[model samples]
Target chain A: MNIRGLSLETIPPIFTPFRFFLSAPLSGILAAILLIYSGTDIWLTRWNINNLALTHLLTIGFMLIVMLGALYQFIPVMTGQLIPGSKKLASSIHIMISLGVLTLVTGFLSHSRIFFILALFFLGIGLCLFAGSLLPLLIARLQNQLIVFLLRILYLVLMVTLGLGLYMLLAHAVPSLEIDFRNYTDLHVLWGLAGWIVLIIMAISSQVIPMFYVTPEFSRNYLKMLSLAILITLVSLSLYQGGYIKALEVLLTLELLIFVVYTLHLIGQRKRKIADVTIYFFRLSLVSLLVGIIIWWLGRYLAQQTFYFLLAIVMIYGLAISAITGMLHKIAAFLIFLHLQKLSLSRPTAISLVPNMKQVISSQNSWIQFMLFLLSYAFILVSVFFPQLTVLAGVFMLLSFSWLAYCLFQAIRRYQKIQLEILALPEMKMSI
Target chain B: MAREIILDVSELEPPQPFEEVLKQLRKLQAGEYIKMLHRKQPLPLIQLLHENGYAVSMSNSPSGLWEIIIWKMSDPVSAADCNTQFGTNIIQADVSSNR
Candidate 1:
């Protein structure tokens, strides 16, 4: 149990978390771009097998892939332990997951059962490999209360979602399986969104937000209670979808209230009082989340198609994308800083190793993206009922996401350049 | 007259632990200065000290060891000082520096 002596070559403890950092936001960007191009006019009509393909493109391609990578990186840091798997195993899992997402999306779009089955097999295998690789690290470092709890819940939700996904895919191929795809799909989305993604984000944010911004620590009791409440609501809603609607509504409202209060508290207490673009992004995201909840609640009561579309746009494009974009700016800068700091320690060179955080992501471009996203989101909300303005919103969304993707690419390129510079240092020649 | 307090932190576990040493040094001798020799970048620790009220000067030795010189501040006492002053487990002062 000598954590310090763990070979750095065996997938740097941070590598897994870094993977999530890269994959998650990029997945959102990709999904947004795809949806924009496909035209916003199409309503739930888009929720067919083809749209399922698009869904996986976001969920599996973007969400799970990023989550897996994050788990790899963050788990070790949290537990003060390293993953037991080799780098090759991690690479294989990445490849399999990527291929599986592509294949699954294509299968859903083409209505090809063979490809559908193949997609399930590949994705399932990839997930299993990932889980297997991470299990030891998770088990070994069960002492870290916050991280261990988050990791365990994340893995459980992932397993349930993946199992349900596989079952649904198989049922599509062979209808005699007696499994209800609709129920399973709904449960999968709930678990994936609420149970896995949100829980982990909350857990990590409780630690990182204070550390990064030099804010006071959040109340541990409040955080623990919120986590449990969210988990219980998600499980209850899954089991009793119809009966638990009122309860779910109350719980969701409570959760959002807690989040808003906590986020505002953190921002208010932040030591760095400078105007940060990332903080602005977070503000926009919180607003979007509020709008989304209102839309969902309205949709349930009014039965309006407009409310439904607005809810989707707010949640998927608005809150999700905004938070992701904001995080990418920080994560990219932080990783580069970490890598350079490691190098600077090893090699005492006069090289200006640290890249200014502001330089990593263009504030102007991010603000532009934020404005465009908001505009497009508003237009889409209007177009859902009007229908004629759909093409205009679609165009705006296309431009906004494209610009976001470009910004991300530039940031990554800058990071890569820094990496190359560090690698080129004569005294610090070690494989990354 | 300028006096140099040498701290051989070759055996220091990590940056955080090393900072504990800095804190103790700051407390034991208020006016005397420090020139830390360590095999790792002590910039973070230096920055921490600076933020906490100590004025620091940093340089690199020819043999790749980092040298950080910290000077005590000549100012009114602050709240952070009270905490650090009374904090018993802040640093392992018993672990004698090899220098």
Candidate 2:
């Protein structure tokens, strides 16, 4: 009832999130390039260096970067709390993370022991700083709030994921370390994918889908228990990985099935009947989630390595990437539009008119980007079956990301141009 | 006398308030004004109204309900030309609520 989050007067500076948003697509383009040049051989086994490099490039480089930015931007919106830091801290965090991701990918591809160690150092410091920035705000308001509690858990799991990853890299680089990397592999991957990524998505979806899409709110009874359910599932799944209880896997799968179904139902009930590209992205993401889980479930009976690899691909690329892409397009455009609107209010009679969100980032451009992404996704799915199609998939990925980058860049450019035009007016000083 | 269109969009989730407000704005007559009750300021809605030559003044109550009255520029009783005290009260109320 306070409608505190809706009040934007105290939110962080625009560049804080915008810098991350702008950098994300470049990482996507890099991932596509890695896929193309690494060739079909890289697609055969998920354990290959190229495969590992490409996955991180997409997951850490693109998805995590965007999520980090969104967290910085939306946490304030969600909690009605200010992010603790100056604008300088935000920029530094962005730089550290970007550098960390770049170095980590380079280490994976080059097989340099020092690079791997440097990767750990950079990534560890950056992630810790990032988490520290949000921890205070989250800690202050976590009482009796399910979604924020889930987000807090997500951050905890992310730290665990990063720790396990560093240890794995350490073991690999120094065989004398005597760490069992294999023992931690599945746990590391699941905690990162299911714990951090999916949990954050669930938290955001619960708030956003209803708010943005004008859908019936998700069942309060079910949602209230979701964070606890997910936490229990993750803990149980970790124990199950250590051969403690087989039944936990079933519980985890059941939780996911319920989540996917509930999300689909909410999407179905959305009242807005418009040709929204963001909605299409959400549909693609939700469907991919279902498909990924089914593939994961089949791995118990099939026992095929390819199925496991395919499951990872479908989950990370198909599900996670698709979901974030939808979020990125919507959030980026909305923030720009919101800021421009607020700025324009100062000079009421200015000759320059502020552009609406749709006008700034045209629906037609987004649709084209979506179509390219869809085609690329289909090709990637096909490539999983016929490895020879990986290059074609790579090409499509390149085109899709290039188009995406172009659209985002164009929107940013438009925002800046309008800002400059508005500022040029002598009346702007009066409004501020 | 033109009647006021009262829209209580506080119960309706986000963007629905946004969408509904925009829709109602289209149907607004020259002499008519809308008294919209919402939980939030609905900044985007306010912006669109501004762009379309409408004037809006909103006040937030201590109970957290926001009352937004919007009228076209040409309207006799538009916020722009209303009793200065009415506008002053809304602004003072908004400031006090924030405090």
Candidate 3:
């Protein structure tokens, strides 16, 4: 593939992506706080309002929001097509989604139809604008079949998730619909978690691991086959309920296992054996994936719903959060430095003002956060089995996310500071 | 004869490759150009070159290697001379002036 065809011309302003990155940890902070306030009761069952609120807090507020940010960033790099009116689109999308998530979380907590109504309106318009905006661009790009394929599915499943989500919201908003929320709940989680989130993880990791880590590129045909397998299994999973389909039973776990092995192997073989913090996060993510599988496997044998709770904890807190944090460390640092570098270029005197990658977020600071994250993960895992210690887990989680927000904020703060100094220079000949 | 500093960063990762080029560009004098051999297109590096008052010539060799030749546009070089010496893969060889 002519990867260079991916142009920098379309890169949205630094704030466009940074705003989303910055918001993720804030969402994590809220999730952590909720985990604390909800207490051990959340560990009892997945359907409880407290647990549901916590789930959306992480899923929609944290994970999906970051993914949405990445969508804006990646579309330009992958396809070389700029969103025609990105600034306004991004601003509006950000506001709507922010409101939508707030209302949705409030709806869950209060069990209020009004909040649900407001959430559906906000998210519906927000998600539709997001989907509507992206659809045209992805359809136009045909160069790299793999990326185009991944992006198209990401769009489709997002809409699918949105549709199911809206339908569920309607059931809540209009009580006369008599919709059995329980029946669709399984399908909703399956599509949202596996089809949308996991596949996106697959799509992104396949490229990033190789490119960023200097690992061997995963075989194209192999990845295509893997993606196809995921698609087929997701369809089978939703359709077949009479008897558990073998592929459906095994595919999600099997795919994750394969991914873990594949990624670990690639990381092991990377050209530079550097002891970087991002590498540490990736390792933690892989290890978390393994633990998640183990927890899930153990869930099958347990009569108590505690194991299910453990599995979710391992997946969300341990796996998803670890990977997202790692990627953010690199991405936030890169974009900040790149923008600084660009700004510093106009005046040669400003060259010295630009911070190196490490200086943006020190290895020491990131390491501290990483360790805290691991500690938080450990406590969360233990809390599932030992509910009394749940408060402590929430503290660790809060500390970790707060540190994360700080570190991300530092990079942005530094960027703004340096950018101001550069702009103040006399005879500034260029502008981004 | 023109001066050339040939540096190969095929084995280095990320900011390393970009940093190596910046280091060369720092002490570079008039009529002296840096020819960098990299494994992939340094997109960020290219963007920096575009932003800064620098002239850049990037040619992807048939072996899937990238040979990037850049110099300060203030200290100009002739495109005709560069094209003859650097082979045919040069895309947007802004050697004579800035964009």
TM-score of each: 0.73, 0.83, 0.91
Candidate 2 per-residue lDDT over residues A1-432, each given as its tens digit: 333233223446678888888898888899899889987877666678888888888878888888878877776565544467735577887888788788888888888877777777777788788778777777774322655776777777788888788788778667688988988988889888777777767877877786677677677568657666877788777765465555776777788888889998988887776668888888888788888778877777753767877787778877788778777777778787767755665565442466666777788887887888888898887887788998889999999888878888888888889888877765533231
Clashing pairs in 3: none
As a TM-score, model 2 comes out at 0.83
As for candidate 2, its clashing pairs are none
lDDT of 2: 0.73
**Across residues B1-99, which tens digit of lDDT does each residue of candidate 2 receive?**
555789988767543576567557657766677889975556555534554566666767676578888776666755444435245423211222131
Evaluation by lDDT, superior candidate among 2 and 3: 3
- Candidate 1 residues lying further than 4 Å off, grouped into runs, are A1-33, A44-46, A141-143, A176-178, A241-245, A418-432, B1-99
Interface C-alpha root-mean-square deviation, candidates in order:
15.0, 7.6, 6.3
Whichever of 1 and 3 has more TM-score, that candidate is 3
Backbone clashes in model 1, listed as residue pairs:
A16-A69, A16-A72, A16-A73, A17-A70, A17-A72, A17-A73, A20-A66, A20-A69, A20-A70
What is each candidate's DockQ, to 2 decimals?
0.05, 0.13, 0.27
Q: Candidates 1 and 2: which is better by TM-score?
A: 2
Q: What tens-digit string does per-residue lDDT give for candidate 3 at A95-173?
A: 7988888899999999999999999899888888888887777777545577678777777777777788888988887
